[model samples]
Target: MSALIYCPFPDREAARAAANTLLDRKLIACANLLGEVESIYSWNGERGDSFEIGALFKTSAALLDDAIQCLAEMHPYDTPAIMGWRCVSVSEATAAWLGELDRGG
Candidate 1:
């Protein structure tokens, strides 16, 4: 199985850096960095908002937990937003690649 992991970062540079790290480490095969995502939330019991970048990573399900752990360790925020869901359908080539990744190929 594979997943499309979603995570939000405070800046494009941060998102790109994270993406590169994941890709280089083979934790993720690809990362789509969507920048300029406007976000609204309450922080420290106060209403706040800002533009953020979203990172969508393509990776096997086996890497989800560890990848999120790494993100938590490296994240700058008090709590980082990292979520992932299994991919039920994908191209055969992509699926095979994900399997290979899980096998540490």
Candidate 2:
């Protein structure tokens, strides 16, 4: 039941802040932040390109909703790109760690 959530922020600081908030709330087990990434997408019928900080959060399915809520509350962007999917496969250790978080360990 493990999942990986992807959140893109306006900057590295914002990403870090959101990640820290999620961690503090025990909504996610781990977060890996990519300091710089170029994102090209169409918003409001216009093509836009910008640099962003991408964060990957590891957690269990049970915490996915909480993780998304944390991101929405802490993200600086008016509409943050918060998306995720259930992991099809994961190492036993990683799954165990996520389970521990689920158990409040």
Among these predicted structures, which one has the highest lDDT? Answer: 2
How badly does each model clash, as a count of residue pairs? 0, 0
TM value for model 2: 0.93
User: Over the stretch 1-105, how does candidate 2's per-residue lDDT look in tens digits?
Assistant: 899899888887787888788888899989999678899999999999999888899999888888888788778888888998899788898889998879986
Candidate 2 stretches with Cα past 4 Å from truth are none
* C-alpha TM-scores of all predictions: 0.90, 0.93
Off by over 4 Å in 1: none
Q: Candidate 1, 85: how far from true, in Å?
A: 0.9
The C-alpha lDDT values of all candidates are: 0.84, 0.87
Pairs with backbone N, CA or C atoms under 3 Å apart (clashes), candidate 1 = none
Instruction: Compute the lDDT of residue 31 as modeled in candidate 1.
Output: 88
10-54 per-residue lDDT for model 1 (tens digits): 898888888888877788888898767888999889998888988
